[model samples]
Target chain A: MKASDGQLIGYEKEGSELWLWDDLPELHMEAGYRIDRLLHYERSPYQEISVAETAAFGRMLVLDGVPQVTEKDGYIYNEMITHLAMVTHPHPRHVAMIGGGDCGPAREAAKYTEVERIDVVEIDARVSEVCRLWLNRDPSERADSLTHLHHADGAKWIRKPPVPIDVLLIDRSDPYGPSAALYTKAFYKSVYDSLSADGITVFQSGSPFFDMKGLRITTQRLRSLFPVVRTYWTAIPSFPGGMWSFTLASKGTDPLLGCMDRLPTDTRYVNKAIIPAAFELPNFIQSALD
Target chain B: MKASDGQLIGYEKEGSELWLWDDLPELHMEAGYRIDRLLHYERSPYQEISVAETAAFGRMLVLDGVPQVTEKDGYIYNEMITHLAMVTHPHPRHVAMIGGGDCGPAREAAKYTEVERIDVVEIDARVSEVCRLWLNRDPSERADSLTHLHHADGAKWIRKPPVPIDVLLIDRSDPYGPSAALYTKAFYKSVYDSLSADGITVFQSGSPFFDMKGLRITTQRLRSLFPVVRTYWTAIPSFPGGMWSFTLASKGTDPLLGCMDRLPTDTRYVNKAIIPAAFELPNFIQSALD
Candidate 1:
């Protein structure tokens, strides 16, 4: 029996869905999605990347055994990760995205009327090609206007001038691999130097439950460089902690002071209500970040 | 290979971790916890009752095969479900609790210095005793000061009077079988008539993702009776939806106008930051309730 056959809905075989991350043995944890099939799997020069067409979440891009983005919930991540900082900075024109290989952040930033240029610096060009060819669907139905794909090391590349970015979106992978440099204070200083005087940078902070040290260290690193720093979260069921934290580091403008009563572009999730609301942390998580 | 040999942790065999609900098989989903052991299993006059001691979640009370409460994250649900309404009311003295046989709501309500008494009306007495003898560890360290458990049907019992309750916590099971009447429009009217002039009531609304129909009906029912009704959500990773919703209905005062700066007692999760944040729903969910 299968769900497609409409035979009372719950008759699919267990082995039909086979994407589970059994990597985190310490917490006795694993999480993955129910996909239609594995679409593309290959080793890029940087990392192992796999794309899938999920049954519930549409297309998904998995890198190194963890899900980077899924079509269904990508808007929640991409919109909040981009718009939270973009809207906070008074006039964010030239936005820089570090390690957004999937082009999700690029597509979102391009939606904003205020954003003139978006430089998405992904280490692996193959991830962007895979997404462009397979996973990139017009989720919000916005015209992909101005997102320049740059294949280079983001840590060193952002040091050079590129229009003095007003807002930077760090959509990097976790802090354990080649992406580790992006989490350092020096890297944050480099990002600070690349931004305008009133610039803001947003990035996905690690889950506090499973990656408390990473979250603590990341927040500390950002706080040392930026004047105003805060942590917010979003929920995607297939993730390890179910709650994913995002940090906004600004020079003077605070994202919590997000009062752009109306967005310049359309979004599925991010709104004025969600801006300050997202910063509310659970007590345990608040303690972990402390 | 085990976590229990003179160790601070407890470990059990992989076989001990079972009972994934294959009932909702169409989504190809299941969720279960690693158990220390199945402590109790039997059928009450109403429905099935089973208890288990879990590795990650401490003791779990699963009624009719759905988890009622888990020790690890029970306080998160217990506190949010109780305090959100309790704090909103001007002076919550006499409170009412329905269907919380695990005494989670009663325990949390007893923490309030302003709450002199709480009348807990539950149909099943056996469920209360089972938890009292086994699972009620007082995670919040509040003395069992003023929660009186009444063994009576809540739907009919709440229709009667108990000094005109100030705050009501309806911690019923899912909106099905025995617990279905509590979600009806008429039952909501009964609750409305039972409350004080400035009273507020709160209940666990169904998940918008899996049980949208129930969420819709619950919100509709609450809206028809109360002047103000709002839906808020919390995340308990082990639950069915990973996200759970609660509805707060007030006679004239709005729960959304919550501005209680502090609490009278200690808590691990709920704080002033979480109140307004919890009420901020995602766009799709806000549309569902609309």
Candidate 2:
């Protein structure tokens, strides 16, 4: 009774086990994990959030029918998106994570002792509630980085915050619908203006393989606003195209030039070597932007 | 109505569309491709070979329920497997391709004028015949590098060739079943013996993400024999784990040390920038092998 990644959630429907394939129509493919059971599913105020436990990949959270975060490889995305910016900044005390309602990135950001406070601005509160209550594996900590949550537009929240942010990590949905505005150059300019002098921003660009135009155009736009822009990638097995791209932008600091003198030892994906290696964009990807 | 990547061979079954996911049980997941129609399927004396026309990616060739080659990204694998070592060598005269039954590797090798001859030792003749007949888009030439096809066991053929190979490319299936011997130290010893004094060898190891042990151990064995060994990677979007690792070994000339002076201007994947970047192993992979 084993199935491929796109086995479409169930074998015989109607009364059988309910399964789902997060259909990526644009890519003409769908991706689904092997789920032991669908633990939770409902239409939130913004998008549909479904949480399921998989026999292979632990727990998987699908939002808007997209496999947003699975317990298995969520750390890879979370670590790269958050730590790349945090480590790049010499002294990152305050961090702002946008749309990572799952609270995975904040959990990792909180690991740094240098981080004094974190402001998580998410468009959806239900995502944070479900993840905090049932989805996420309890770290069993007294006060973790799941600290402040702003159920408001992330684009607007960055315009005027209480204090200037040192690191901004955009962990939002695909660049579509309300998330589309976050991808614009104006929004990035707003982010550039509302930051400390040495602040760094990291955001998921898109799949460099299939969505070449989107990634290429986005990087081009960022280059216009930021003094330094670097593109890096990692393989998320559950996501469509498998290869996911993220761009790092800094006003004056080059992420590649900014070295990790003091590094964390406990990480499965991100290590000292990857900081430089990941930035080495392939020939096709480099050409795609050109 | 839309099929997944591995759904190439099965669709519109009986009357309704019943897509099949080619389960890579080893990886504990299946893969599929969008299929407009199934072109051909039969046992090719060695394994099952199926040809299907896809909507997103062009033609797909599935071997033993595995979508081994797709026209969309076929050049990526073929170029990386062949050109990485070809370019590494100063002058590759005689190239021996083992287990590339589809004749794809030889077709790439034939492109270089410096390559006088290519001996394609494929155990499965039917794969070459099938590809040449239907799957391959020919270069419109008579007697290309694919002129010579020695349909024999690659493991045995490497022990005693008519002339020693200047460059040896192992383009076989995974290190399993009939292809298991090709991965052994004894077989590698034979390959080393069959190679010319400055011969270089490049072969697919395994995915570092899931098959960490396989790739690590294989690199370990290769390092014991070769003076210079380097591991590189490329992202094959449709493949399981998304990221695939390739290892390069040389008798005297190092792949990384070898410079790219004259570059091909027609390639979509391989270029001067990628030659070094690919060899920059991630910390996790380097640590796993270490």
Candidate 3:
């Protein structure tokens, strides 16, 4: 159930049914919206479903009323992940996104003026199928030319060899049950090893309130690996706990350390005035980081 | 129902029987192992009997699930209002709060250290009664001695004569139903008249997301009356809307123009490190402000 905005609102599902709700509007989208997209259902970790195509513009996945990912607001999160890193880096031509099966981040990666190639490593092929069938009506025509989708375990791919990646975006979920290994230090260091000298990597942590200890530990571990590591927070109306946090790690210059007056004029949520503002963590987060 | 940590999770009243839920575990109190207190009922806002007590002290106004005021967290908003002006001012001693009946803002006034005398003009006697009975069990035990709690309609009190209020805190509710007159320009001009040279006054506008038009009108009116007026926003978790906005106006010396360094200790939310962070309005607010 969502408490805040439609942008980052939470939704949950059971078996073939998918449901989403917000505070102002009691019930938003529901099972009727899910148009024959159920590929697989598993109750081992938690009641989660792998869906194919939905009547809604986006691919739907729900676990206990929490919307895992959707194609509509995917651009907001994807753009935030890819653009923030790409723009900060001096020249990030080669980029890698981990666990973003939907390829939304890859699509956003192609938008960067400086980026040449984008690689997406996702484990779930069903997610890619949903994206291709529903999310991207004309996938081949609309997607960025520089995009390359890979079906593989993101952590395993990063663990081994790779021609030095420039920007790596870890868009994985919580580090519990299914997504546990993804949050380990070994995977993060592998990610650090895969990046170029002046490379930057941005990873979606979890809600600062609910996932306090997780956020703190992951940020601390990433800080140990990278020269400059910082946590940035934002409020997405759809996300659980109403607030979300991200960890940015870089081997090159600390992007946040120095002020850069020049910024690309095409921004919706971010601007020159709020560059530093985004990095300003709450008291609870500050205490956790300390 | 309330969330954990002794926050006023939610409130519901059926007839004279009011239901209060504390999201957290049982709180410790001198009276006994305490639960949530029934602040008021729908039948009468003034008629409230404290059914419980707790060690965690603060003002609690439970109206249809929303806790309007609490003592512990009240300082955050009050400090934000009082300090945002006081620090920007060359000398701000004489202060007044328009509708802070709970005396929480008045209590925060005592913490300013700089201010010589503070007056709290409240329209309702029941608000003070509730605060004293349910929230602040011992009101006369504060360290500061210069606060004057006046029981009078703030709007009527401001119209009679200019009291030269250096820092005025307008802690009224939404402008639609009960608090309609408080949002008018006439009251704002009276507030302007009451302020000394370069004096500052901060007032709660409304939810930027839901009430953007209202926020714009209030801010525009404040700007017309004052030479320097800027809108500052802060996120209150328990508010009706997820994000809340405040308007900070001054006769001179734009509050946003200066750097905030000095601050009173014992602050859980605001500090020197995240001072600029408070002014970072959300995208919806920025759009409305623009």
lDDT of 2 at B206: 75
Per-residue C-alpha lDDT of model 2 across residues B152-233, encoded as one tens digit per residue: 9988988888888888998867777558778888888888898899999987887787788888877888888899889998
Q: Which stretches of candidate 2 lie over 4 Å from their true place?
A: A1-19, A111-113, A133-147, A177-181, A184-186, B1-20, B111-113, B138-147, B175-181
Model 1, B74-154: lDDT tens digits are 878888899899788888899888887888887777777777888877787888878887788764344355767788888
Lowest lDDT 10-mer window, candidate 1 chain B?
A: B1-10
* Top candidate (TM-score): 2
True contacts recovered per prediction: 0.33, 0.43, 0.13
Residue-wise C-alpha lDDT for candidate 1, range A20-123, written one tens digit per residue? 33244445433334656667777778777777676656777877666778776677777878878877887778888998777777777776677788788888
Model 2 Cα interface RMS deviation (Å) = 2.2
Put the candidates in lDDT order, highest first: 2, 1, 3
Order of candidate numbers by TM-score, starting with the best: 2, 1, 3
- For model 3, residues A142-201, the per-residue Cα lDDT tens digits are 245777777777888887635688889999875654466788878888888888888889
Question: Which candidate leads in lDDT?
Answer: 2
Judged by DockQ cut-offs, is candidate 1 incorrect, acceptable, medium or high? acceptable
iRMSD in angstroms, per model? 2.5, 2.2, 12.1
